[model samples]
Target chain A: MRHILRETWSGLKRNRAMAFAVMVTMWVSLSLFGVSVLVAEQVDVMKGRWYDKIEISVFLCTKVHGGATDLSANTCEPGQETTPAQRELIQTRLEANPDVQEVLYESKGERFADFQEAYKNSPIKDTFTAEDMQDSFRIKLKDPEQYEGVMNEAVTLPGVQAVQDLHQVLDPLFAALNALVWGARGLAALLIFAAAVQIANTIKLSAFTRRKELGIMRLVGASNSYITLPFVLESLAAAVGAIICSGLTVAALVKFVVIDRAKPFIDTLAWIGWDAAWVAILWIAVTGVALGVIPPLLSTRRYLNV
Target chain B: MITFDDVTAVYPGQPQPALHRVNAEIEKGEFVFLIGSSGSGKSTFMRLIRHEQRPTSGKVYVAGKVLSNLRQWKVPEFRRQIGTVFQDFRLLPGKTVFENVAFAMQVLGKRTSEIKEAVPEVLELVGLTGLEGRRPDEMSGGEQQRVAIARAIINRPKILLADEPTGNLDPATSVGIMRLLDRINRRGATVVMATHDANVVDQMRRRVIELVQGELVRDQQRGVYGAE
Candidate 1:
């Protein structure tokens, strides 16, 4: 062990600059991977928490001759009006369902009020008045998986015309975010792999340049492990240095870049915060070691040519 | 004792075998000169003893271990028992003379005290006792070669293989290096040196094994360098 360490120490000291260069390269590459993985995980967690709380919206039919009828004129009989009593019945039924976690009743006037606030300056806001909207029951299910069951039950209700899960409503937004996350992960992996290869090649070339010295060591009775240990250790040392730098960079980006820029949105978001910092830290450290070990193992094996 | 039983070596990317059907043996404490012109397989023979290249079709037994049949892991252990020096005086350029000599023992995992004890003793034997702290660049060619010798013998190997040890030195310096190797041989370590220097070889009057065009041409006890 001492022999191996002595060899490692000598090698590192001999090419201190090259070692440092390799390390810096590893740090930047690995930091990008670490940060991206953490952000994706955090995004997933946010999706889980928020999607669990989302409500399923059930649109009520129009009232006709003391009964409910489909709101669209094309689907409705001659004269139909969606009544308050029909909406009340639907809301009560949704509230009593086994899968229903809660039910929120929204009257046409309330829907109009929300719409006016949602699109205050839009031209379409004045075109459709509060009375033109259908009364709806927003039902929160116990789990997101129960959404289909709840939607089926809701659409079959006496006064219901249609039911929609909000995820389907926000599908475009979720899809865009998911695509961004996966794209970032793919890009990060590619860059990190390139960096690892770069590091391996650099170390390999260094070994080749010093083949004469290594041959001398061998002729002079230096053990095989002793000759190999320095190259391995040099790679590891550079990796460690790079990993540390990458970790710090990741932490800094998370703190100053992501969190700072997203502060307003994050503050209003009910359940996202710094709880993922430890997980990020763990990922960074693991990435550093893996990046350090894998390439060196390959490069040294080739360098040894045994 | 080292013996070659009809050993032949063919290196890759070469047109022909470097050594061909060579048979010889050197008993313990024998100081022998391996004489040949360049490309006459002198270096190849040296490498075979060190197991750098295995014999293509025959056996090479060094101190009872067959070099051709040795496994990869056993190679380093095998080399540790046989010291080797090269023509270029392969000293670590960045290391001090003491460190270079101490390195041999260090690789064998000898304790610090053992290194502290052994390195100085070997340096004294090589006549580089006071130049221990100097790097290779700071020393003369002869001094660097002495450092290489000290490194080779520090582990107290049973056999010392010198491939053109004085090929790059002046006659005076070459004689000095030869005498040091001779002294080590006298102390019971077998010395096998490959050289073309007729003056040193003739003066030593040791056993000689000569090779020509990859074949053994002569083997003479009390041999002269150019006796062919």
Candidate 2:
């Protein structure tokens, strides 16, 4: 074992150029793999934050239970105004539901004030009044995903103007993010394959150069593993270098880009912690090492017959 | 000890066998010379004993292990009991003579103290006492072959197979290598040398096996180089 260790270190020194080339190749490949992992991680964090904030917005009435213009198929029927008693009864029912958490009542005057505040700098603020604003109840649920039940119960209520869901708006954004994560993962798989092949190529090259010594070792009764260790260790050294590099790069990405940029969102809840970043780094490093190792085990067994 | 029971080797896709129904044996501590011209299966004869090429028919027994019956993974363990030297003196060019000699023990997973004690002894036995730090390329052909001998014998193998160990050396150096092999054989390692060197074979006064066209034509007890 000592001899194998000595040989492994010496072999790295003897084949430093190939070792460096392999390290550089693995770094690039593992970095891509790390980025894919981080991207997936960041997407999960964003989804969690946005999903919690998602609410079923029950728009009550602007003109009445029915309006003048036909909005859509799910639009509230055209009638007189939504009665105050009916609105209060609907609010009470929403608050009583176990799925509902907190129901916020927004009158037309409140909605108009919010609009003016949102568009405070725009000249368009002068064009709209509280009459143009619709009154609605923003219903926060215990679990945001159980929104279908809320929509069904609220839409048929007497005072409901129409039901709107922020979840619908957030779905497309989440869908695009999920797509991006899957795309990165697919590309990462390709990069990992390329990295594995490059590792095998590097080992083959090292074996070719050391053919004479290898034959001597064989003649001296060296076991297949004894001969194989040096090649394995050389590639493993490259892998270790790649792992540290990728880990640091990934940590930096999570710190500066994901956690920092999404600070405001993450502040509301525990989205991405250091534990998640650390876990992601470890996961990628282990994967990189495995990819670097399996190739030499295969190629050497085939090419060198050891 | 080594024995061949009608061993024959026909390489893949070859019309003729390299060795044809050739039977021979040599006991422990004996020195023997294998003499033949080129293509007379002398090299193939050495390879058979090392399990480098298995017999297409029959068996080869080396120190009680059958070459044909030996598992592929255990071939190294079988070769461990035997030492091998070559015509080109296959020493690692990048390593010093000390490292080359130490490698023989290193592969066996011998302890450092054991290797430290054994390597110098073998180097001295092979007359390479002062050349431990020199690389093969820095040495002469004879010195390089001496390093090869040092490596082969460092592990104290029971049988030593030398295929033209002195082939590339001049007459004087060839005799020197033969004397070294003679000394190694005297120390209880069975030495089998293959050569067409009439002078070295005539001088050794050892048992001789002669082959012609893959057939064992002569097995002479206490033989010289040839009939002449």
Lowest lDDT sum, 10 consecutive residues, model 1 chain A, at: A68-77
lDDT of 1 by residue, A174-266 (tens): 788788889878988888888888878877887887787777666655666677767777888888777777767767766776577766666
lDDT of 2 by residue, B1-228 (tens): 899899887888977678889999999899999998998888889998988888889899999888777888898888888898889998888789998889888877898899889988989998989899999999999999999988888888999999988889999999889889999999999999999789898887889999888899999988988775
Candidate 2: segments with Cα more than 4 A from true spot: A1-6, A57-163, A258-273, A302-306, B131-140, B202-206, B215-220, B223-228
Give Cα-based local distance difference scores for all models: 0.79, 0.84
What TM-scores do the predictions have?
A: 0.81, 0.80
Q: Highest TM-score: which candidate?
A: 1
lDDT by residue (tens digit), candidate 2, A1-306: 877777778879988888888888788778888888777877787777787878888887655436654342134546556778888988998998889999999988998998999999999999988887888899999988788887788877776777888877888888898999999999988988888988898788878877887887788888888888878887888899988888888788778876777676547644565777787788777887797678888877853342
lDDT of 1 by residue, B128-215 (tens): 8788889999988888888888888888899999989998999999999989999999999999999989999999999999999889
TM-score computed on alpha carbons, candidate 2 = 0.80
Q: What lDDT score is found at residue A110 in candidate 2?
A: 91
Supply candidate 1's per-residue lDDT for A103. 89
- DockQ for all models: 0.45, 0.52
Model 2 pairs in collision: A60-A161, A64-A81, A66-A77, A66-A78, A66-A79
